[model samples]
Target: MKIHKEGFGTIITSTIIAAAIIVPTVLLVMPLYPVLGWITVIAILGLLVFILSFFRIPGRQHADGEDLIVSPCDGTVVVMEEVEADEYFKDRRLQLSIFMSPLNVHVNRNPVSGEVTYSQYHKGKYLVAWHPKSSTENERHSVVYKSGDKEVLVKQIAGALAKRIVNYLKPGDKVKQSEEMGFIKFGSRVDLLLPIGTKIEVQMNQKVKGGVTVLAKW
Candidate 1:
């Protein structure tokens, strides 16, 4: 597995902090209370490991097809329902949401190959990922991809623990299916607004991998 580019700064900062704390404990505290010093070392090291693991990009072949809509992030599906469109479309749509925990991979991928027709960021409240209002009220970046006659909107939403949402696409940019679109720092959720009548392949509460699992078909 390769570490993502987004983690470099964070990893460096964490390494510095760990060394600062570990060095003093080892020199001054370890000689007095060996057990406590060892515990401190272990705890700091474990936390550093978790930070590294959060940005890991595992090696795997991604799914791709013209009519297939792949999952944009690794998480468990928390919602699959038909709801009235509120933002861009202003019509009915099938909304599918995946909830990503702090332990889950945070990389977001493009679900289809097409030109980006809309890319907008919204500033809002940070609600818990599973809350019904979080989809609209939470901080988010929305992107719409137009492939032929179909257009799909994908939203990267920030949860209570997530503070940064990174998106790399803009209107008029061409994107391919399963390509990296952004990264969400920490825990969050992703919402896909699909055109009504789209065939759904995944079920509620199902686990999915970014760029690997087939979510639906055009």
Candidate 2:
């Protein structure tokens, strides 16, 4: 597994702290409290492993096609229904939401090849990933891509545990299907609002991988 570049600073800082503080603290306690020292060592190691795993970017083969809509993030499909979109579309749209836990990869990807037509970031409250109102109330970066005659909107939402929303694209920028779009630090959710007539390809509670699983075909 490859470590994502986003975690480089975190991993380096953690290593330095372990060497400067944790290791020496363990050594000093080993003689008087061997068991406590060993436990501390294990906890520290576990934390490092968890942090490393959180940002691991596994190799992926992006599903490429002009009409294919790939999963934008790894998680279980939570919302798949028609809803009134008040932001960009301001009309009824097919909404597909992916609920990403801290354990899953936090990277976001483009679902289709298109030119970004709308991009905006909103500062809001941090709610749980699975909360029904999280998609609308949480801090999010909204992006819309226009492919020929079709347009799709994707939103990166910040969850209770997620503190940062990193988006790499802007309006007028062209993006390829399944290419990296951004990364949501820690846990969060991704929402895709498709045209009403688009075919649905996935079901609720089904696990999907970013840039791989097909969510629908436009």
Candidate 3:
């Protein structure tokens, strides 16, 4: 369990903030108001831990098979159904949506190994991750991967609490399955559009781990 590269700045900032409060509470406030200062210390510690955990990158072995689709991020499956894709596909596709809470790992992994064919970032609103409109209306980045004759799309969406999104892949780049694609700071959502007729391996509301969970097989 290592601190994810994406959280270096965040962890440092969080540490400074936590220490500012914790040090003062321990050295001065605690001497005067023991109960109140101790509570403040504990609260600061909890917040620091949460921030560290959010950026943690746990080791994981990606799902096997080039045809298997792995989860892009750790979160709960919020939407799974056939939907009309208004983006690249412009046709009906099976969509799987994952909602990432602050408690979940924020690293977005590649669902499949392929050459990136389409990559775009959109400026938009910051609604809650589960909001239906957030998938399209929220600040997001979309990347499509192609392997052989199959192509899949993944979108990283910003939620009400998430304001920053980091995507490293661009068109023409070849990415490996389960490799880092992006990181969404704080809470967010990820949408995966699979080819029609693909088998859905997970159900709605199911919790999934990034890189480790098999979403479906192409």
The window of 10 residues in a row where model 1 has the poorest summed lDDT is 81-90
User: What do the candidate models score in CA lDDT, each in turn?
Assistant: 0.97, 0.92, 0.92
As for candidate 1, its clashing pairs are none
TM-score of each: 0.99, 0.96, 0.97
lDDT of 3 by residue, 1-218 (tens): 99888889988998998888898789999999999998999988998888889889888777767879999999999998899997899889999999999999899999998899999999999999999999889999999999889999999999999999999998999988888899999999999999999998899899999999999998
- The window of 10 residues in a row where model 2 has the poorest summed lDDT is 18-27
Better of 2 and 3 by TM-score: 3
Q: What is the lDDT ranking, best to worst?
A: 1, 3, 2
Q: Which numbered prediction scores highest in TM-score against the true structure?
A: 1
lDDT of 2: 0.92
- lDDT of model 3 at residue 129? 90
Clashes of each: 0, 0, 0
Q: Can you give the lDDT of residue 6 in candidate 2?
A: 82
List model 2 lDDT by residue over 79-186, tens digit each: 998999979898999999999998999889999998999999999999898999998999999999999999999999999999999999999998898888999989
